[model samples]
Target: MGILHTLSLLFITTPLLLLLLEENVSNVEARDHHHFGKKQKIKNSPKLSPAYSPAPAPSPRYPPSIPSDPSYGPTPTDYNSTRNCIFDVTDFGAIGDGATDDTAAFRSAWKAACQVENGVVFAPSDLVFMITSTIFSGPCQPGLVLQVDGVLMPPDGPDCWPKSDSNKQWLVFYRLDDMTLTGTGTIEGNGQKWWDLPCKPHRGPNGSTLPGPCDSPALIRFFMSSNLVVSGLRIQNSPQFHMKFDGCQGVLIDKLSISSPKLSPNTDGIHIENTKSVGIYNSVIGNGDDCISIGTGCSDVDIEAVTCGPSHGISIGSLGVQHSHACVSNITVRNAFIRDSDNGLRIKTWQGGTGSVTGISFENIQMENVRNCVIIDQYYCLTKACRNETSAVYLSDVTYRNIKGTYDVRSPPIHFACSDTVACTNITMSEVELLPYEGVLVDDPFCWNAYGLQETLTIPPIDCLQDGMPLSLAENSSYAC
Candidate 1:
């Protein structure tokens, strides 16, 4: 009718303008698929981010009775059947030039790589063997291994080596058996040029005012060894006694890392004289003296998981003269952690000396800021003019179970001074706790007829001796207190 009604409104506005041009091309292809998925998520963001992760972390839950204690056992043998020989002190031509005396090419490469049978004398990987006195004579046949991977340097500058009375132990492992001293080595005892060598005005076996001839020479001297094993070493700056194990047997000093520099004189870190079944586990002795010094014929000794600080704790004797022997007996120092040490647990005896210190035990120790945390010096070499001697030795069955923390109220956490003539018998302090710095609560005494004023000394009143009372002495003598 009007040209078919204007072509029926041009086919109904040409199907509504092709449905609004396909809805604006689907909103411009969903805005170009949301900018191409944000440029492919910023080009795959560094492969899902995490630059350097070689993977390793998450292994620390210790306390399965803290590793079954026989001094944290198990490691008798089979360290890969052991046999690692490598020795290279600059290819046996070691010329650190310090006057060139490489000690017979390091004792003929340590007796030809410790003469076979389970050998291990590997000391290569970057050499430095300027030695002076190196004697490792031994019967090290049963699984022999002395792997000190480079560095036994000593004689550098100090008047071209002057200190002499002929005793400069850089490393002398005498009378050995199952030996071992692993890699990442170093035994540098240049010892401040032997502690500035000038104190030889001697004449004292008791001459009253003249002492000075141990100037320096004892970095490592283990005489009479047995199934010995010293692992992962680092013995440094020792002018004297950094590690001395005289008369040893079945010893095992593991992961040792000793340091010396707190007025470093007579640096006694590991001194176990007259040893028997000894074991110093996971060490780090910071020395001046006795980080571990159990002198006078030690027996079944065991110091577990150690870490004594600033040194001088765990001593069992200044004991006796004429060495009447028998100072340390079946001992056990467990789960140790002494800090700022100076006698966390000591039993020093030497007012005269006779010997019979019985079964000692200090368990679960964890001292901090220590300074004589618990001490017993019958009269340990009493310095500065004070001598009322008398100790024909006898500190019996001593035990300080589960000692815990903090000390130093001018040093008197517990001081037992017995032996005016033997009277420190069967002492025991269970679950001992002293946190003094002026918080005083001191009542734990056991002195006993101290000097024997004809024996009438009795003590049994610390809450009726903590519930299980029974301490009677001569005039009767019972037990359990």
Candidate 2:
């Protein structure tokens, strides 16, 4: 070898090595700034285009600034910059290998993040974290954020589920206030094995569920929380309800996608109970059970601009079960689209129930091929053996406005079977147009003991509505208003 040959080789290789180092540095910087509200650029390499920018950070639409009623207690504000307060799960010994259990690492990271103001529990990108049945309880710092830019999942199924834990819920956030959980992440509830259990509905002969232990868990739940915001996440295949809010107030959930197979039993998209001042906006949800079911003690709740399909459309009841007293009011659902669902808008209460349901509204809704576009049944029994009773939940001041849709011919487009003892009052409907899907009406609006005022002409012409208030408002003992 000659000196000239060695010198030429060194000169050529040095520039190439320097270029590789520069590209690698850019990649590292981009990863560091991911989803943390920062900007970083990447230089071109063999794989990517020249000077490419990665996906943008998580936006500040956590509690979405929109028009709302003043009754909604408080909305969560934007989070403070959390560059120094990041508690990465990997730093606490998380493997992120998708198979190994990382439950302890997640808990530890949350605990540390909850202690500081504007603390961030960050699950970085390009990794998969597997956790178990865990609770993220808090009454801690106000501006906490959980940014999951990675894949989060649980154990494979019932066989791998933790035996010592309760099967009611997988992840719970209790007593949180002014917290924001927004991410461009995925939370995959590995629920196929649980869904295949014998106790699930329709898994037996002739549409009968088999006899077995049938305790499925909700994937994410928030209990006793206030001023919470959740947005910009994709959740799928939950064991039960995808997300539930129990006894929560001033909540805002938007830009979320929740889905499951239509055959997956009892997979409600989102269920809320005893929650107040909630706003669910601009989300898409499809599952087996109700897309959104509001239970007892919910009030001042507003749902707008949601798309639901392959779902049981939004419901306001099945309330006052077991002859209990239930008082729900001031719930409004508007500007929604539902397609191929069992029911479009329903309010059902059990017989022999006490208390009253008032000030409910469903407006500006569009439906396609729905079975029951409008229904109000005072006899909401799951089993066919429900005994008839004399007393009933007092119903009044309910309005359905501008609801246009197409329906299936199996059931009537509008059905109102009110209580025998305490009749419904002020049940108003205006501009409701419903027609059979590519067919004629096999059944008209089925009404029984319902009384209201028809301000405008109906599609099927509800002549059964007795045009006045029912005497239950003044005569019934259970009526509140």
Candidate 3:
């Protein structure tokens, strides 16, 4: 009787145990599915730089973070889609013989691709296209990519350039937005002849300027554009500035190998005017003029990890030229290395201009045998014949920190040739040690009518800087501009 009872109990409990086990397995499967779905979502999310953060309004005392990686741009998509359409220059009758005038083919190709929603105007590899001074104007489709895998050479000399084309610019990209220009190709401006002209510096034994057609064209110019990216190209031997941006916004220049002869006159690596929200990163620029030149009406510009040498290191303006109202603000250049350059960092403005330059910073700079390691030449004049003017561009709130390097003994380690009436105000320098390159006699930091404070004692002490801004310029509205 006992054995029969035990058997009955076991049979009844067996079904209940099996039901619990099945429920447990279902719960485990559901949890695993939910976790996998989360993981997939994370994988599909857009990858962005964790380091980059833009500065707030007014001025930031610290360096603004930026995207660390250089690989941020458009990618491939479906070929059938209009936005993903690719138009090769060869399809438009380009010969790529290094002598044929492929300007027409390039223009035609650009027109066809520009109409597409997200088109690509491709210059295929293993080709050398000799294009003329052409203007590629566009109100093109969004996300257009100018993928250049071939060499694009300008006319061999100034004589070959068309008479109708403006000598001030070449390869103009006007009114284009959301465009990326990238490839392992070169844009070579055979500029030796242009530099040899009488008007250029190569003419005279004493490097004196002569009278002639002096306006040499920039290799590439972007006018009135937004959201532009130029990367992975070697732009070399420009007649004037290698790349010029005017009235543009949201420009990203990265990984460019821009080079010109050290004696190449007026061949500025990159020049910006009336542009804002610019980022120049991971580039090497060696030229005669400023590696990066900031002109009038520029603000919110950031430069990082650039190596500039055998050139003017970087400049903020020969602004307020010809008595124009020039206003530049919120400029920062950091993590840069300069070697054998003319000026490590410079802010130059002409006298007799009505405007201001404020909220500028240069940090983490390493200079090698640079001249004028830190300079603010408010009375900047190319020639010494510039007459002093009472009304000048107001310069204030400039900071120079972590600038350790060697400076040439020809000039003072620091030069602040401010205007008499409008003295530079609130100029701060900290952690700066600029020793003479080879001589034991270190030049004193020159401060001509400048005012500011040093956070600590610099290598060559700057005792000439006054404590604060002048009372007259404090309430002045010119600085507000």
Top model number, TM-score? 3
Candidate 1, 434: how far from true, in Å? 42
Q: Per-residue lDDT for 1-481 in model 3, tens only?
A: 9645533332222434323212100000000000000111122222222211322122222222323245656543343254348888999999998999998888878877777777888888799999877666666778778888899988878888888656677787877888888887999989899888887754755767686647787899887888888988999999888998889988878889999999888888999989888888888899988899998899989888788989987999888767889999999888788889878898888778879999998987887789778888777665656777888898888999888877776677688888889888889988887766665435367787788889988867777778876776657676666
- Candidate 1 residue lDDT tens string, 1-481: 9645533332221434323211100000000000000111122111112111212112212222122232322232333344254444456565544456676666666665555666555555455667764556655445666555567665753455535412545566766766665556777766665554444212233433244434356767777777676766788777777777777677777667888765455577787868788766767778766688787787887777677778777677666643354456888877777767666788776655665777887876777667666667666543444455543567666777666666554445566666554566656666655554333433343342332111112111123122221243232111111
Candidate with best lDDT: 3
Give per-residue CA lDDT, model 2, range 319-349, as digits (tens): 7777888888888877788889988898888
How many backbone clashes does every candidate have? 1, 0, 4
Q: What local lDDT score does residue 89 receive in model 3, on the 0 to 100 scale?
A: 90
Error of 2 at 149 (Å): 1.4
Those runs of model 2 whose alpha carbons end farther than 4 Å from true positions after fitting are 1-81, 205-207, 472-477
- What do the candidate models score in CA lDDT, each in turn? 0.57, 0.75, 0.76
Of 2 and 3, the candidate ranking higher by TM-score: 3
Q: What is the descending lDDT order?
A: 3, 2, 1
